[model samples]
Target: MLIQILLILGFVLVFAITWRRFGQNVITFREASLWSFLWLSGVAFTLYPGLTERLASFFGVGRGVDLILYLAVAIQFFLIFKLFILNEQSERKITNLVEREALSHLNEDEPASANRPSNYESNG
Candidate 1:
């Protein structure tokens, strides 16, 4: 059907983007592989939606759509959690670097300032 064809195309597009990201070093090999697998799985499920129904039934869910929605939400939450952790780590690193550089600059300027006459001292 037209819908299946469109779904397949969309999945292919996702796979292409994942591959491009991996090639460009924007994502690691493990990340690309996981995403590629997910896209391929999407294509497979779209091609045979009955599988989702069967899985849903096996898991005691009333409908395949519901199961998919639940899974998508859970995945979204996990990804958000991971991004939060990474963001926190990045902020800590930036703060530490800024503090270290400030201390180093202060240390380098101390001896020079010690030998320099202050404007008030010079005027007096």
Candidate 2:
């Protein structure tokens, strides 16, 4: 009964994530990695009941492994959010660097081009 509920929720989460990740350019490998992880984790959580005993003993959880899994999922979500923030920050820095480089080259050329060789001259 309880397991069935968990299974349903797990499938729902996977479906939602799949739909969301569709038709988008994953600019960063982090996005791709996270998507894969979520889908895989959703499957694991859905199938957790069967491995409850094994995981329970492995983790030394007396009640069961469900709570541990729930905690793990929550932590994973937190980590994903952090990864997203870090990725955004990195992209912003890259954009700024590119813009600065473009401007620097433009400024350097205004005064330097007049004295530079006109590569367009023919050897005729």
TM-score, each model? 0.78, 0.40
Candidate 1 per-residue lDDT over residues 1-124, each given as its tens digit = 9999999999999899999999999999999999998899899899889989999999999998898999999999999999999999999999888877775565446675376433322121
The candidate that wins on lDDT is: 1
lDDT of each candidate versus the true structure: 0.87, 0.67
Model 2: lowest-lDDT 10 consecutive positions: 115-124
The candidate maximizing TM-score is 1
Measured by C-alpha RMSD in angstroms, how accurate is candidate 2?
8.1
**Model 2 over residues 15-104: C-alpha lDDT tens digits?**
566555653553355765666675665566556655656667677776456656676898889999999999999999998888777755
Residue 84 shift from truth in candidate 2, angstroms: 9.1
Candidate 2: segments with Cα more than 4 A from true spot: 1-6, 9-23, 27-30, 66-70, 73-124
